[model samples]
Target: MPHTTVLPFKALLLDMDGTLVNSDAVVERCWREWALEHGLDPAEALKVVHGRQGYATMAVLLPERPMELNHADNKVMLAKETADTEGVVPIGGAPAFMAAVADLPHALVTSADEKLAQARMGAAALPMPATRVTAELVGASKPDPEGFLKGAAELGFDPADCIVFEDSGAGIEAGKAAGMRVLGVGPRAAEHAPTAVVADLTQVRVVTDADGSTSLHVTV
Candidate 1:
């Protein structure tokens, strides 16, 4: 058993990739291919792509490129990501944590478009949350707070009442910017200084109350 901590919050906001699902292999593969094709650095490409929308990543990597070019490239990246589910799986304890939160106010907020979100979540055999805020639903991506804010609204909770689970620096920043407490997941995410950090949801359990309030018993 992992060391644990308990946080009482009324709602939950979850990041899909790296946070709930493991799709690093497919993500890195796609980004590397895109970098090679564009003569950019694959290392840097992977660094910025993990928690951002494809178009956002492309915009940073090739700022001088036309919007049409980046949009078109994003479509290609989206299609490839949707079609490639290789290595996609649930992060440790994510499924169980999700199950425990099924009755609580919770939302899945993702950088991936709707199609890719469904594909990857399906690949991981995790049920997609009904209140999902995807790239297609947001005006901006991670590090912008749009997705997490949308999630909080969709779940009918104030951002202050939500505890966000994220596995990337961009995601942690987004959550904080949305005025929520964030629980960082994964080693790569620790440097971002989330409200609290955990290895994965394996140590976290949701407690749903009769009044519909929820709290998290987390193993730190």
Candidate 2:
């Protein structure tokens, strides 16, 4: 039997895409189209696309492009993504995990704006967390730590008292930068050096103490 790893925390911060919801199909469709339209390599663009807001991903792929232009393109891309939820679905064990934490101190911190976040989560049939830090709420994107920090603050927990669940390089880095322990959620998160990793939410069990503190029992 695999040993279980217990990680304690007062709050939880979750990333949407590639973590709670598997929106890879829609993500690939939108981004690949955008990349090809701009004469960039689709393969290369996708590497930096998983964990960032559209503008941030564009800035990385086209460093010479003006920030305003990236922002404009991001707006269009967000609309396209929001409108296409044809392939969105919950990650393995995500529905049960979300339900387990529904009344706990948890928040969704994603690169997606409010509408996109809602669309994807709704498409995946996952219940949305009441506290969330979306794109519009942050001045900077993941890998900058702004979103995670804001999520911790909104949940009334100190960074060290929070545990972040993520599946992207940028999201892992952002969680670490915010001083929270991170639980990487899938194949994509393996190389990111998260504090711990689980193949899926199936390998995880959430426990609430008599005092109401929460801890995750993860099978690594």
Candidate 3:
């Protein structure tokens, strides 16, 4: 077992894809297929797609494409992602972690649109947070602080009072930018300089006090 540290915090803000839901296989497949359709490099496309909104990724990769075309293509990609769920699953320990926080204040913050969020999370059999900041609700995505900020707002907590769990560099950046201490999820997250990093949600546990305060105990 890794060393665990106990940190008290007011609330949690989580990113969906790599943070709460495991949909990498389906995400990759959709993006790879879209890459081939657009004559783009699949490797490069995959590299930039994760932790980003579909339209934003499309905008970055196919800058020359018209906005209208990007919108249409993004819709197509969203449909494809929603319709496919061959390998969607919860990140190891995700279910347990979620159960621990069931009575605490928390929200889902993700770069995915509502439809994609519903599809992926549904496929993973994960419970949805009552408060959510989805792509459709925010003008900007991860690394911009928009979604995380929105999440904190929806949870009725100040950004600084929240702790975030995220698996991507962009998501970590967004959390920090929102003024929340972040627990970087996954090995790759270490490079992003989050407040702390953990192997997965399993490495952390949530506790609720009798006074209704919540804290996270993390195994670093």
Cα lDDT listed for each candidate: 0.87, 0.94, 0.85
Against the true structure, what is each candidate's TM-score?
0.94, 0.98, 0.94
Off by over 4 Å in 2: none
User: RMSD per prediction, one decimal?
Assistant: 1.7, 0.8, 1.5
Tens digit of per-residue lDDT, candidate 1, span 80-191: 9899999999999988887887877888899998899999999999989888888888888789998888888877878888999998888999999999999999877889
Q: Which stretches of candidate 3 lie over 4 Å from their true place?
A: none
How well is each residue in 1-220 modelled by candidate 2, as lDDT tens digits?
7988899988999999999999999999999999999999999989999999999999999999999999999999999999999989999999999999988899999999999999999999999999999999999999989999999999888999999999999999999999999999999999989999988899999999898778899985
**Candidates arranged by TM-score, highest first:** 2, 1, 3
Q: How many clashing pairs in candidate 2?
A: 0
Query: Best-fitting candidate, measured by TM-score?
Result: 2
Candidate 2 collision pairs: none
